[model samples]
Target: MQTHAQIDGFDPERIERDVRRWLERAVIGFNLCPFAKAVYAKHQVRIVVSDASTERALLEQLGEEMALLRDTPADEIDTTLLVHPQVLGDFLDYNDFLDDADALLEALELDGVLQVASFHPHYQFAGTEPDDAENLTNRAPFPILHLLREDSVDRAVAAYPEPDAIIERNIATVRGLGVDGWNKLLGD
Candidate 1:
C-alpha cells in the first residue's frame, strides 16, 4: 500500500481514477512508460499490451506480453527492428529494466522482437521546460490495452479476492499507506 498525492488522472479517493481516465481514450497500448530513464521518477504511467502476434521467437520465449519502456527514446538506437511477432511477458520489473537501460538495449539487435519490463514508471518526471511535452508523453501510460477486456474486471476479483498475488506484487511494501489505509490494521 502507498499514499500518493492527487495528480492528473488518478484521484485520491479512487486511487486509480487518474490512470483510468487517461487510458480510456488512448490510441496505442502500453503497460508502463517511465518518463525518466533510471535517473528521475515523478509519476506512474501504466498500460497493457493487447497482442502477442508481433514478437519474435526470442522475445516470445520469455513469455512477456507488455513492456515498461522509458518515455525518452535512446538518441542512437532504433527499436523498430526489435518489434516482432511472438509470445511476451505481462509483468514489468521497473527496477531491473531501468538500471543500465541503455546498455541492455543492445538486445534489440535481434529481428522481429519487442520488449517487456515491470509495470513501474520510475522514468516519468515533471519538468519546468515548456518544450518538453514530447518527452513526457513518450513513456506516459495513457491508453492501456486489454487482452481480456473490461468485462473481465469482476472475473479477476473472484480469483484474486484480497489480492492473492498480482496486487500484492505491484504495489510498494513499506509505503506511507499507514496514512492511506494500512492493510496490516485490518489483518489483511
Candidate 2:
C-alpha cells in the first residue's frame, strides 16, 4: 500500500477529490458512462494513488494493483483506478504505454480477466486534433490507469440496449458539450 507521504508534487487528497469530482460531475452527472453510477453508488471503486516517477516504476505499481485486485473478491472491490501523477504526463506516452500494459496482462495470464481503460487530461482519438471536443469524453484531471473486470464489462454490455452505440453516443455528447462548456465544467 502506498502512503500519502510517498506522493510528491501533487497532493494525494486533491487527486482523490478531483477523481471523485470527475466521476460524479462529469462521468455520472453527464451520464457519459452509463455503467459508472451503479458501481460508484455501490462503493466498489478502488482509487489507488501511486508515486512512480518512471514508466518502469509505474508498471511495477500496476502489477501490484493487478495482484491486489485479483486477490480481492468482486463483491468487496469491483474495479480500481491506478492513479499515477508522476509518469506518463504526455498523452502520447501514456497511449504508447498501454501496449506494454497489455503485454503485462498477458504475462500475468490475466488477459481475459482484467483489462485497462485509459483516461488523460489530453485524450485524443486517431485523426483528431489535440483540442478536439470529442476527446474530452476520456479526459480527466490527470492520467489514469483504469483497471476493470472483464466480467463486469461483459455484463454491462450485455445489459445495455445498444452497447455498440456507446462510443457514438459519447462522442455526440462530448461534441454537444463543446470546448467552452467542457472547460467551464473542468473549472479551467
Candidate 3:
C-alpha cells in the first residue's frame, strides 16, 4: 500500500474525516441505517482510504480489504468502508463495476459470508430521475464500497423492527430535508 503522500492529494486522514461527517451528519444524523450508530459509536467501523486509479489496482485493494475483513475479529472491526477516490468517478461506470465486485465475492467463496453495499455521490436508483430527492439516500461525498459481515447484518436486521422500511424512511427523511437542508447538512 502506498503512503498518503505518495498518492497525489490522497489524504487518508482527510478522506476519513469526510466519511465520518457523512456517517455522523448524514447516516446517523438522518438515521438512514439504523444499525450504524452502534458500530460507529463503538469505533468498530474501519475506514480504508484507497488511492487506486485503475480498475486493476482497485480490485487488488479490494482483495486486500476482503482478506483483512475475513482475518480480523468482529470485535475489532465490525464493518469497513473502502473509500476509493481515484477510480470509478462516473456513477454509470461505478454502477457497472458493482457486478465485478459481486463476482469477486463469489470467486472468493464469500457470497454469503460477506456482502458489498454501494454508495456514491451520484447514486441514482433505476427508474428514478437524476434530480429525485430519493437518490440522496444513497448519495455520498464520494464513491464508497461498504463491506459488511453477513452475521452482523443479520443480527441487525433481526433486531430492526422492519428492515424493509429503511428505504422509504430514508426517502421520506431526505424529502423532508429537501435540497437546502441537505446542502446545509453537508456544509456546502
Please report the candidate that would top TM-score against the real structure. 3
- Candidate 1 has a TM-score of 0.22
TM for every model, in the order presented, reads 0.22, 0.93, 0.94
**Predicted candidate 3 versus true structure: per-residue lDDT over 99-158, tens digit per residue:** 999999998888998999999988999999988899999888889999999999999999
RMSD of 2: 2.9
Candidate 3 least-lDDT 10 residues? 3-12
Off by over 4 Å in 1: 1-17, 25-113, 117-131, 139-188
At residue 55, candidate 3 shows an lDDT of: 86
Off by over 4 Å in 3: 1-7
Superposed Cα RMSD, model 1: 19.3
Candidate 1: worst 10 consecutive residues by lDDT?
A: 78-87
Q: Give per-residue CA lDDT, model 2, range 119-188, as digits (tens).
A: 9998998999998888999999889999999999999999999988888888898899898888788672
Instruction: Candidate 2: list runs displaced more than 4 Å.
Output: 1-8
Lowest lDDT sum, 10 consecutive residues, model 2, at: 1-10
Candidate 1 per-residue C-alpha lDDT over 1-188 given as tens digits, one digit per residue, 9 for 90 to 100: 44333332333334234334323322122111221221112222323322234333333422232132222233322111121111222213333323323233435331123332222222233443323222223222322222111222344346543644432332332132321232222121
Candidate 1 steric clashes: 31
